[model samples]
Target: MKKIIFSVLFLGVIIVLLMQTELGQMLRSGNIQEVAANIQSYGWVAFFIAIAAVVIQTFFPVIPFVLLAGANVLAFGLWVGFGVSWFAAVMAALANFALARYAARDWAEKKMGHHSFVKNLNRHAETKGFIIILLARWIPVLPSSAINTAAGISKIPFKWFLLATLLGKIPAVFFESVLGHYMINWEAHKGKLVLIGIGLVVFMLGINYVKKKKKSTLLS
Candidate 1:
């Protein structure tokens, strides 16, 4: 398990290194406008291309926020872009949820579980679990994909999971979309960035406190 994780991390580093190149950025930026402009010169075909990319994110595990979502908001107004972003993100979370539950169930149980938190999470789901999933979506830093998969293995029913996800993921993405939209107007974006930084620091402190409590319990 550790070996697999290390391999994935190593490959990620290599990919990031490659992506640091200007040429890589040019390609990955989804510069459909420039490409299509070269082909035609008058009209832009970037809209269709971006939507297609959003759909592809469901299968590909790509978070197309900058080029797809944020750019969508910037190009098209906040409402339309935000709606598309929410749909794409929910679909991706759903895909990961099922994949982790049915395909990598045993492996994930061994790796991601093995902790009291995970056990309790499962126990909650064994009874009533939708609330926890909803909370995960409410927290911006908690990846919806992780929450979805964790809930799936929590022994939560598929129907409940689906309903929770559909209802829960909306606000999360909408909030992010608003952030991205506000960011288009640079001054507001700066304030939001500072708030995000402060939020991260608080989150880390909270996590550290929890860890210390757990350690103290072990010592006792």
Candidate 2:
């Protein structure tokens, strides 16, 4: 407990220190281009900084993830940015899960046990855990921290959570990466970007339809 508190405090101190710099100004402004320029100024260490930013944001979430994604895409291009963002996000999810499961599950249960959603999560975790996590990651409307915490406190196996998170995060991460790149160079990729956006909307609609049908069947 003391260790966790200390680590959090240490991270807080680091953030405060970083906030005093010009890079921090860029980050506070939420200017993707400026953030990318700051990242580029660091050369090879830029990747490390980017990954750390993603991981930290998963826990603290003071910075918007989309901003980080956009900055990464502008700094590293689409594919590399996608790879880095996806990897960092997955790692962060795993960390959040581990922290919740190993460190805080008992406490969380005592606190969140009264919530209907947590109760439902507990009930279905063993049976529909993978699908639940997959959909949550795929849709991304749910908070990533919430999903990780819920999965941790529930009966889902680590392997199932890992697989679902890995598979489900792909499309969203890729789309975000593409969106980030297009934001910078939209004039060049306008047609392709529009098609991708349409495809994503159609895919999300199909998933929603399936989910609704499944729910109705369950109710019946």
Candidate 3:
């Protein structure tokens, strides 16, 4: 527990320092224009840095994925940006899962054991992990880190996780890329974005309701 607290505090200090830099200010502002310009300044190195940013954000998501994806779109254009975001996100998810499953599964299980949600997830993972992962991936509001860590400690097979992640991440990444591209002009897309957000919330609520109903029926 002391080690964990120290690590978190250490990370916090690093973030504070980074925020003082110009690049860090741009990142903190989440101004896609400034971020894209910064990436472009590095020339070809931009690709590597952009991909690395996506990967790193998996473990430390202080940087919003939408911002990164948007910056990629501005720097690399629509299709290439979508490709980069999707590929990097998928790879990042796998890496996070592997780290948890191989290095920290036992520790994480012990820590989260008393949590009812974790127990329920473990039970579902034994039977419906693939579908759960797939749907979870589709919900951009859900934290990818949570999904990856939970799956890593569950009984779900790696292959199933990979396949489901691959299928689920495609549309989600594409949508994010597109959203980022248009978000450059918030006023231009404000109405559409609002509608989309409302729709997503409703869709998630409906999914939850259906899931609960199905579980109740099965129990009865």
Candidate 2 residue-wise lDDT, 1-220, digit = tens? 8646755675575586457656666666767787788888888998887887777678767667766887788889878888889998898899778867776666657765676656776788888878878878867457787888888788889999999989988887887777767766779989988897798789878988997999999999
All candidates: CA RMSD (Å): 7.6, 3.2, 4.0
TM-scores of the candidates are 0.63, 0.79, 0.80
What tens-digit string does per-residue lDDT give for candidate 1 at 118-201? 576788885667776766677655655557667656787777778778888687667676665565455757888788679868
User: Which ranges in model 3 have alpha carbons more than 4 Å from their true place?
Assistant: 1-25, 114-117, 124-127
> Cα RMSD (Å) between model 3 and the true structure?
4.0
Give lDDT for model 2.
0.78
Model 1, which residues run further than 4 Å from truth?
A: 1-68, 115-117, 184-188, 195-220
In angstroms, the error of model 1 at 151 is 2.1
- TM match of model 2 to true structure: 0.79
Whichever of 1 and 3 has more TM-score, that candidate is: 3
Candidate 1 lDDT (Cα, 0 to 1) = 0.60
Q: Candidate 1 at 173: error in angstroms? A: 0.7
Model 3's number of clashes is 0
**What is the full ranking by lDDT, best candidate first?**
3, 2, 1
